[model samples]
Target: MATGTQPPASGTDPRRAGHGVRGATRAAIAPRHLRTDRWWLAPAGTAAGLLAFVVYSTWRAFSNSDYYAAPYVSPFYSPCLAENCVPMRHGPNWELFGGWWGLSPALLILVFPLGFRLTCYYYRKAYYRGFWASPPACAVAEPHTSYTGETRFPLVLQNLHRYFFYAAVLVGVVLTYDTVLTFRDEQYAWGHMGVGTLLFLVNIGLIWAYTLSCHSCRHIIGGRLRHFSKHPVRYRLWGWVGRLNQRHMQLAWASLISVAACDFYVYLLATGAFADPRLF
Candidate 1:
């Protein structure tokens, strides 16, 4: 009855004092919110879209079929270096392992672009919100009790994004070469253009845009520079990359769609599902 400590004021919380609500008891609530605003739609759509692409691409990669048509190779199977790669279908046929391994040709090359996208800054944010529901949306609360962030294990590998960017650039170069080769006919003679050629060209352009607009590329171009006057060329390059970075999200999605579309187009041509119209 004569306790020295005073009770909290009628309308205020004692636990909310300097340390906001650290040890406060949580309300026994059901769902976080009851308002009907279609909040779950975004993540749902993202999950569905990404899942469809993953399934289709994985199937195509493992099927190892119809990845190439004369003068056009699917972006999924470019730089075909496997011995199992059909000489007529996948081309290149670098025979890197000399027919020893009976693996899918896509196994040899999809990793670079896959790694690039997996570690992409925008993709990381997209999937984190889309798939993991790590605080899924703007006002949503995460299901976890603690936050560990990206400082450990699998997430830590995100640091390798810069290296993956390098690999992606080389892959882009290979794809560009494939695009150039598309100018030739089945006999390797130049001056041919088809519906497939434009598709490959557009796909490569989108990929280059996406890759160049990457956050890692932006940093490499301008991160540590002290004085812009000292390096006007680098500064100018950085400015260009900065502009692209501003649209990185759009480019990322555009490239994803285009790459898949390009591969599917080649698949159709290879399977004779569709005839490539000559644009020449």
Candidate 2:
């Protein structure tokens, strides 16, 4: 007999047998649970929340009786696309052109969320996380890995962010300017809007909060620069930024909710939901 016969099958030699069994089991059932363990859950949930807020809010906005597509016809739609867009006032709201969406207060606020959702770093995070729900904003499932392929329409909509950046900034300025007009209501004039100055202030606050918490901006502002820590102010700001970042998912969710809720109040005031919003 060979003296080296398989190392005599020592009592402590269970390792090989155990590993073989585990390897065989893994090989047999590995791919089945891949779908459930998908890595895209985080982003998916955040996006679902955003879309729910938008769609519900949009429906409410267009369905209100405070706006329409024509002038002085019960509730009226302010002519929006002309060189002479009227400041919104009392009007009936409804759809027109068969299924075309008519204008209203909801539409006004939608600009901010829609724009922010696209341009936001947090939203990008959500999108990257695979948001494992159904398709949100036109998506149905998270990709197993990176989405390197090219498609049109829905994919192309991502480009809308650049244009929406302009829109969001313009809207922010307009809303701020409207704030100025609201405080000095003693000097009101045509095409001037001063409603919800405080609410608009809230919107601005939310924007700054979201902007400062951004990953790109954070990195731009000493996040990536180690030497900047020598400066007390930079260090302090970075410290707070870090705090926000620690609860980043929280901040992202809260900021979106805050902006949307603030917008909703303004729209409600605009559509006469409340006699006058509690501006305090």
Candidate 3:
């Protein structure tokens, strides 16, 4: 021992002997964080943007009447499983939930895509900083006294992100089908196209980009492979996914905004706000 120096405590780093470890002790700093510049702006902006989307999506989900127009259906209400769906032909016609179910058909199907977003790894970072303020930004101290991470209850459900990825893929497929259906006119003629069709095309494209770029999708395509040389096909696909994954955050926001805009366009048409101008 060096000249009456105290011994290092258990489960701590020697280099950080004077500094604090999370869940052990607070650092000797006086401020909440030592950031000098405008560090709070990013988290504040994230919180505002996320809150706006939640409010808009929640309102649209409940007000389901305007979500469906001929040859166009909102992404939020696709695979319309209920019999009561407006213009039921837009749906699969299976009516899995039966006519007895009276709630918005959007509610029935939104869970899958919603679950996918809620459990998304990127979104976890987003909301944890934006909504929860759990260490809102880099080097910032969280107000929470303790952190359990995603180990308990609702947060633990994040492990189901992989499963939700499958559901999101299915939803993407359904949205593609819906977009294809938009090629037809109200008379059901196959040769017609409209401005809404273009919007649908753009929205679905963004949706697929976001969905395929998911961390879970990347893992499913690339994980568990010990030898890249042994599987050239998977390796190529993994590389492609890796490129997309780099833009995951941008794709996430773009797709979210596009889906909402697409649905809003459908709502405008359904409400007789204007006629969908034909491109043909």
Candidate 4:
């Protein structure tokens, strides 16, 4: 009798029986899911929300008119430093290019906030799934053959997120100054508070919440530490930031809505469509 190992069954390849083949030519096969839920809904809603905000903000930013009301300036046009900006008693008077730039004041400052959000890690994930449909949801196949990731040309700009965060902080300072200025009436006297003032306060609060809750801010607070015990202060600071970071996504969306609402409120006041009720 021959003692050689027996041949495998007719249809079975012994080497391929249990393990996945290396360097296989065949495309990957996705597994079937038990749940038949509406997975597209979340991405669809995200896309719609983002689109609506973009449209509204773009229109308001370009409008240039009715961006200010006494004791209230639209967050879109705060720190109205452009020469083309409607005359304001406060805010910087510096205008570039000999004041010939006939652009909305929002144009000068919106870039900072926009760049910060654009390069935000949370926002990148949100829009990547929402707008690009890059594997829109789990279990769904991506439209692209492969992903180049953020290491490539345009996406490489994401590395500027930390720098944008610094600019955002400066912009926040300017906005805070604008909010403080809101306390004074048109005559510039103090002791005035109105619904507009409340709006500005809430808007700034939400902005700070969003900005402080950033992952980059968390890393800056305490990254590359060899030992937590050695840096007690940084450890505590990191703890606080981590708590905020846990809710960063919520803060981000809330801030977005609050800012838009605040801008719209100022617009209404400026347009005489609505009045700011006195709280005090």
Candidate 5:
């Protein structure tokens, strides 16, 4: 019902008005797809190199000949520790290399040294800090203005980090169990290998706990904590978790140190430099 209002007279369609409005809007806002120099490569590279060292050193941990009788023993044996226990097997046994490849645990060594740096919220905030997670010689450069635009890969999956928290926590539990097991295994035949294996297990718990309790995980799972301080019950419970979340970087480094500690514990054992216990 047209009450003196004129309908479109010819070629111009009403939809054209909506398109024009959108076009004008796009012209007003600056485009965001800027290019930056890849300075993150340096730290990333160094981290990778160190990771390689961990892998190689881990391989050495498997050499059976490296396992020999401990040169000294304490006359006072501790059953709980499995201290003064005998070796699981005598040395010069290459057949044990496959089993010794317990070395793949070394592949994880890089996660402690390298991956930890990548997950930092502070690094995420600054280009200089962020580059450390990448490679060497990378620089802080301006955002690129080329604005080619998104070809694909929408970032919806980033939410999966919340799920990763579950995985990391589970791994922590596994590591804790491994530590508990180390004590059991060494009880029957305490040696360097037993103690070393236990140490690795303990470090696993440290790293996984650090990773699972990271700030990134908080963002992924905690949703937002802006007003929770007003809620007492929530503050009491969630506040505890947030404490770890706030100290994310510390946890990362702590985990890194613990992982190395774990590796050393076993490496020395594999070489017979120390004695483990016989828990069994």
Candidate 6:
């Protein structure tokens, strides 16, 4: 018998074999990736951007103070679920979880939006490559020797993204409500508008864009339909969503930055850093 390399097992075709199939092999390249055109920059930049947001959000979430300014509330603290919340004029006092919950009111509601973004399909790909260095970039070798995919414990939770999308939609509605409240002046009159109002409007717009552009939203609207012609309204709506879906990554980052900026603007107002300029 000849002791030599063996071909793939009988009837097996390399092209048809799915990823992570046992005994799969690749070209033996000495370098991690042959392409040298600044591949590391993308993953590095992504990691830095995500990390900065995480740190800033963590700080703001825990700060508790400066989340509410007259006629404006931070996006991070909408719905104001704690009894100790600074009231927003014309805003619903839908406090729950009781006075016993003494933590930041932001903490009460941040989970839903955070979970939605955390489980976002684009985000999963972003962090997996950026933070986990799973291949880091295209054609790059990952340090992980074995790939279980999302079949394991924590990664398996990504399947709950669809449920999180529902929660995100509700959060968007609440943010819309909050933005509406910003239209009122300190006197609680309805006809007033400030710079904050415009900021709130832009923030809410981005939030809705990001929320509605979700892959889950697209699937829910259009998936499982056998015939597009049978549902013309749905087909049109699905087409709109499909266009937005192509820009999902951009919407995600835009919403993130806008939310933080809206919150920070309110923080400035709350801290008396500057007066909210009346634009009426």
Q: Which window of 10 residues has the lowest lDDT sum in candidate 6?
A: 1-10
The runs of at least 3 residues in candidate 3 whose Cα sits more than 4 Å from the true structure, single-residue gaps closed, are 1-27
Over the stretch 1-280, how does candidate 1's per-residue lDDT look in tens digits? Answer: 4554666668765546434556766554688765468888888888888888899889998888888788788888878877777776334446676554566888788988999899998888888988999868777887878888999898999989999999999999999988888997777778998878888888899999999999999899989999989999999999999999999999998999999999889888889897889878
Per-residue lDDT of candidate 6, residues 40-74 (tens digit): 99999999999999999999998878987888888
Global Cα RMSD, each model? 3.7, 8.8, 4.9, 4.0, 12.7, 5.2
Query: How big is the positional error of residue 230 in model 3, measured in Å on the Cα after superposition?
Result: 1.0
Backbone N/Cα/C clashes per model: 0, 17, 0, 0, 34, 0
Quantify all predictions' global Cα lDDT against the true fold: 0.85, 0.48, 0.88, 0.85, 0.44, 0.88
Model 2: per-residue Cα lDDT over 152-180, one tens digit each: 66555665554555555555554444344
The count of backbone overlaps in candidate 2 is 17
Top candidate (TM-score): 6
Q: Estimate each model's TM-score.
A: 0.88, 0.52, 0.88, 0.88, 0.46, 0.89
For candidate 3, what is the TM-score?
Answer: 0.88
Candidate 1 stretches greater than 4 Å from native: 1-36, 89-93
Q: Can you rank all candidates by lDDT, best first?
A: 6, 3, 1, 4, 2, 5
Model 5: per-residue Cα lDDT over 1-280, one tens digit each: 6755766558755555344464443333344333366545645654564565456545533332232223211111101122222343322222312332333222332333333343344333332333332212324333544432223343243334445555555555545544444443332343334444544555665675577566655554445657765666655655566777677656665665665555455546656665565333
- The parts of candidate 6 lying over 4 Å away from their true place are 1-27
For model 5, the superposed segments whose C-alpha errors exceed 4 Å read 1-159, 189-205, 216-233, 276-280
Winner on TM-score (3 vs 6)? 6
Q: List the residue pairs that clash in candidate 1.
A: none
